[model samples]
Target: MEGATPPASATATTPDAPSARSAPAGRPAVVVLSSLVARGSVGGRAVVFALERMGFPVWFLPTVLLPWHPGHGRASRHVPPADAFAALAADLARAPWLGEVGAVLTGYFGSAEQVEAAAGLVAAIKAARPDALYLCDPVIGDQKPDGSGGLYLPEATAIAIRDRLMPLADIATPNRFEAGWLSGLPVGSTAEAIAAARALGPGTVLVTSAPAMMHRSVATLLVEATRCLQAEHPLVEGAPNGTGDLLAATFLARRLDGMTSEAALPRALGAVFEMVARSVRAGSDELVLAAEQDTILHPMAQVTVRAIATPKPRAK
Candidate 1:
């Protein structure tokens, strides 16, 4: 992995995931798969931040190291060549963290080779520790509209995820657009989102950005075989940059702590709403670091989290 300087402005000592609210919690180590843009986003940052707060040892295996973050145009960019996989494999061949490692959480990847490499890492982890949980947050695209179709995940990379990475994942977190692309389902409503999640080959699926068009709200849809759940929050009108990453992180953290999606879904949704509310209050991005940390301590401290019972399936 890479740890380069991205074009965006930098943050603190942690270099990549530095935030005051991001205190370390005594939890297991969760590895993040992404291109570490130095001092980048709360998506990447928040995951590492939140995990660290919970005391889970977090390590980032960036496919590339960016100067800043991908969210901002000014963030500098650096791509680790496709050949770096072998070196990564070798590095993992004898890292002490490998023995203590318990879970793997992958975010965005730049190249197909990186995707393959990430898969290799997952395989190695599982091989070494059979109980290790692999969580794949198919971080392709966020709320970008202009033809950045299907998560902005490269076609080849998407294929690799579907064919290789996904099945190995114990949990998969995908937003609306991503679920459509990954599961071949429609992205219109909550039901569609649930259907898409059910198709991803994993029992635990977290689908975000699922507010129905008729209502100006944000929705997180969770589907687990017979029991489906949905949580909705008032839509924040501006800047929703890093909620996906945060949600992915929150869900992973909760699950790692032995909370099921059914139970963790409410907490994750509350956290997302709290982050957005904090950002709006602070005049910042959708996922604000300071507020995010507070949300972790008190998810419901800001916004109320309500879980609605999912209705039974209707006749096809």
Candidate 2:
């Protein structure tokens, strides 16, 4: 929150496709994993939406199919690993996908098998496209005030990420709680947050909804090998969900397409903040993020990217 911007709101329904002027050159295509039968939950939709708007062609692998709209209510039964992985592998095997992949971003894995499938696919992608970056938004639950547990992925998922995948991942987007859980550290303060990121880091770690004392609302901070940003947004009571998902997607697309975390972090944070602020002012339960869609390419909100804490090595 050291350098934050004022929020913005729009007056009309904005189109999903952003203006051609700001549209950027296409990057290597990205693949996102989501719930197949989602009612379009906030998290999943945000990933798909942010990637496409940023000028990156996007593909999806649904780990589960919701019986109804995802945000509508409870999730329908999940798609077990065997079924989900077979489908995902087939997509990656297509001849047209041979050499153009730039990155693979995964979110909302629902089962242990699904996590395993995702890990194998991530490895395969790297094997085939050695240059492609891997960005994982481990969609496990972060600490919430209501004590809601994050969606359960088998312990295998965490092990795979920290031990197997993070080494390969160019970036990771974890909320405050997930960061602490994954790193086995206390993330109760900005200092702790910075340490956790570096200690558990594969490379740059984008900690979303990571709590901070400077502001009441949840915060998203970015920590890289050398650059880190502490972005603060005012709390909006009863705001829409999936902000972390949206932020993660935005950051990944920019990073893969060649923006540094310094540039991409502010873009992601500013975009989500303005989008949420607009939704709050409109008195709408759903987010009015159409205005911020362009932030996928050009971030409107400005902030300074700084390193607040020194990186510390973790105990083995």
Candidate 2 overall Cα lDDT vs. reference? 0.65
- Native-to-model Cα distance after best TM-score fit, residue 54 in candidate 1, in Å: 1.3
Q: Write the per-residue lDDT of candidate 1 for residues 22-116, one digit (tens) a residue.
A: 22334667778765655645546767887786668877766666666555665566777777654664455235446467788888778777777
> What does the lDDT read for residue 117 in candidate 2?
56
Give candidate 1's total backbone clashes.
Answer: 22
Task: Report the C-alpha lDDT of model 2 over 1-316, residue by residue, as the tens digit.
Answer: 1111111111112342111112234577787876553443265566777787777787777766666544557655756657647565554533244345667887776665566556656655554466778787877665567877763656766665555555556788888888888788988788788778877756888887776546565567888766567777667687777777778787787678678777777777777777777677777666655654555556565544455666544456
Model 2, residue 315: distance off in Å is 14
The candidate maximizing TM-score is: 1
- In model 1, which regions exceed 4 Å deviation? 1-26, 142-151, 301-316
